[model samples]
Target: MKKFVLFSVVFLSLILVSILFAIFSFSLLFSQDSGVKEFEENFNIRLPRGTVSEKIYDDYSGFHNDGVKLYKFVFTPKGMKSFVSYIEKQKDWEKLPLSQSYQALIYGGEVKDFSGNVTGFGGFAKEVGLPKISSGYWKAIGDKSVITARFIDYENLDIKTLINLNSYDFYLAIYDTKKGILYMFHINT
Candidate 1:
């Protein structure tokens, strides 16, 4: 009876240790830092230091929009500038033209006509200046069955610029006319 009790205790301890080891191994395999590493490798740009969030989704499926894996990295002012500089160094990126109408909106000017012309009103342009870069007229096509969907009227700007690297199109739109935040997206075509 004494021998059986001792063996039972030993067996239970081994099982517990095995469970703990497996948990640790699984966690190490899927650590968040690994996501950051993967992002840097895929984009060829170092992620700015700040809060980073990641989501993996099926392509064009469900409520989650765009990319098989989406990573949003929000940065401080300094980090934003650093990232902007990094993008500026890329060979294929170019400054996108800002239309007069879009400029008016950015500067808080009223749109007098539907021609999309900029009519500056306040000094918002002088104060805030233009966003560093904006890009894309992103058509978020959710359903293929809908043939007659009206396109949302928004001035598409290339915030930083656009680049085609390794058969993938990269767009970095730092400012949304509505949201007024820095963001980026890429598509592999």
Candidate 2:
């Protein structure tokens, strides 16, 4: 009787371990890149290579007209430094340029520059401390541009309505100069 009980205990333990392992392996294989892949497919743009995505928030219904999806990507200290260097080299890139389809979706007037005078976007300003706007990469780019891309689908309608779909709206590449962290905001549907 004791031998049978011992055998049952070991078998159950092995089964439990195997189940947990399978669950973990399945999650690792299927769940890792789903959000990033969806974003790329929807927006038709690729995120910068080597950066790690920290969190993806899909706000189906929120304060905005429609909704907003926030994808926060983090970079290592070394990677941040390298990206800043690369941006400095791309002086004539004209910051963020919205594509033609993106342009049609804008409900309001035009996209504006949200950088100059302000230290940083969202919580980064306080997090990184107040950076010297006149020195380093900040000074290189005279005016920091914040381009808004608000996407709306007017498929079968004769007249278009200015409804904010909030899907794949616009992206902001906010860099924390002091900490070398780039906050890439993808406001979308």
Candidate 3:
């Protein structure tokens, strides 16, 4: 009876800890990204009104800079339908991020002056602080390819995992930390 009770306690504690971590990590990511935060405000993202600006998105590095229109998700204060249309137009590239996206992500590496061969999870792990070996874990998920990388949230001590990229072979799957949604980018090189 004592052994069973102890196991239950341990399991319950782990579940509780996981829940706490998820809440905090998602908070951190949303807080950091104004766009994501804006989306969470009302379950919808209302982009600022501009001259149809373009951004070169860097999915892995997490930067909002760059100048490209593909996968841009453009929108106006009162023009989200168009935004949806824009998103739909690029459905073709949904299979994998555009080549420019990959370039943008790599460019982020240059801008940050980070040195490493593997940018997806390997770089994200070191950046998040989940022990060097804990990163770049490829799961044997049958035909489906899943790559889970743990990132240490400096703002919070909890770790976050990026899961299921969808397109391409790489996918970001995160656990215990929020940031549940994945921002995927393509690698040009």
Candidate 4:
């Protein structure tokens, strides 16, 4: 009887420990300052477990009825893979090739220095810290990285179509495998 009781206590202790760990993990991901909740609420997509927000930018002009939101998140390698897999399985997202035209569209016009030399695009995307690919930005994702967007017929569309988008309403997720970071950009007008 004592042996059985000991086993029961051990098992119960293990279960309790597991429950606490799960709670703690959940809290860490969704904490007020984590930005996970806001991102999930706005995008209707939940980031992978163990992901943490690194930076966020929110701009809105309710009067003008247009705004942009950008979020940067760092993920564990495993979490990054998991997110890529999840996005791949989602019907709404379309993987986009990492092309110069799309990069231009995302970054807007070329930025120029005081001497009129082209620097790079200067916008909230720059402010949010999207990797600067124009100057060989190493942090910028490459061919191996997954780039996915939504709200357009990407299959039949070309870069020109993306460039011509008037009221840009789209969601883009770019994964940096080397740095294990995910950059999300959203535009609504």
Candidate 5:
């Protein structure tokens, strides 16, 4: 009789503990901000409806204490239109003109110096860990794409200027209409 009572008591205590743990876990899961909501809050922009894919990359270099946050997303063609429209309405965002070298900014390509010498360059898409697209892919679809930024020197879109920036807040968004991809890259130094 004693052993039976003791077993019953232990079983009840375990059940009670399990119930409490479940309640605590559920509260935490629901109360915390979700990834999509957090992304919107951080970037000051909402993900358009039908945004299908999201890739976020964050890194803080221990050597220089510099950090970068990159977000790459795939949107439906319709969703891309809606997002571009919404971004266009924002006061901070300025639509960039399609320059001959715009593709080199987001997609890896050869860069040229002021002297017209071939200079090395890197692209944001690869930095953000997005899938590699072939060279000239963006250039081929350039006419249909749209780019906007908080600020960038349209004339001096070179690696030197980008590397020389100091303590700047830069926001760039590129919409590849052909592939329905959106790339948002922000640099904080």
Candidate 6:
């Protein structure tokens, strides 16, 4: 009877902890556009919808939207460091089935508290006065493998899209290469 009670208590505790973690994670991601701030701070790029002023390309992943073509994702130093480390450690990456910059942003997410996730912190100080995102990070997956979704970058296309990842199941491989920071776009059917 004691063992049974202990096991049950442990199980319940685990479940409760999971729930709390989920809530905290969602709160961090969903509250006050934290992901956007993260992007702005890390990479010197701005992906404002309805405004594509570049010749976008995604031959590697073949990821593109209807009008705008999104191919490469941008990365930050911290983000690049994390990515390069992960890739160098494994030398292989797994592509997921999620589209949208916001979804891609969650790839190397840190389990920071509200402050860590926030735009300004000690180690994670928010990047300021950086020019909007220009050319982002690019990769040669499998020597040219068509992956999940679409990528868009045009010189002009007032493209206003709201992208949010409801759950936290997206992950990306890290690499330390010429591509400083890493961002991803899905280009699949």
Residue 180, model 3: lDDT of 14
Which digits, one per residue and each the tens of the lDDT, describe model 4 over residues 105-182?
566665333455553433445655677532211112111111233545433444545445554555456655556666
In candidate 4, the residue pairs with backbone N, CA or C atoms under 3 Å apart (3 or more residues apart, or in different chains) clash, namely 111-119, 111-120
Candidate 2 deviant stretches above 4 angstroms: 1-13, 22-58, 61-66, 71-74, 88-93, 96-168
Highest lDDT against the true fold, candidate = 4
Residue 153's lDDT in candidate 3: 20
- Give the backbone clash total of model 6: 42
- Candidate 4 Cα outliers beyond 4 Å, as residue runs: 1-46, 84-97, 109-124, 133-157
Model 4 compared with the native: what TM-score?
A: 0.51
Model 3: how far is 69 from its true place, Å? 13
Return the lDDT, model 4, position 164.
Answer: 50
lDDT of each: 0.42, 0.42, 0.30, 0.58, 0.54, 0.33
Per-prediction TM-score to the true structure, in the order listed: 0.39, 0.39, 0.20, 0.51, 0.48, 0.23
Sorted by TM-score (best first), the order is 4, 5, 2, 1, 6, 3
Candidate 4, which ten residues in sequence have the lowest lDDT sum?
136-145
Residue-wise lDDT of candidate 6 within 59-105, one digit each (tens)? 33433422112323344445545545544444223232222332223
lDDT of 3: 0.30
Error of 6 at 39 (Å): 13
Task: State in Å the error of residue 4, model 3.
Answer: 4.9
lDDT of 5 by residue, 37-142 (tens): 5445545567876565454787746344445566667666677778767766665443443343545655557766676677544655577775543321111111
Q: After superposition, how far is residue 116 of candidate 4 from its true place, in Å?
A: 25
lDDT tens readout by residue for model 3, 26-141? 98865534433423242223333431322234344334321211112233434544433443454221322212222222223322212333333233332233221221111111
Q: Which pairs of residues clash in candidate 5, taking residues 3 or more apart in a chain or in different chains?
A: none
lDDT for predicted candidate 5 compared with the true structure: 0.54
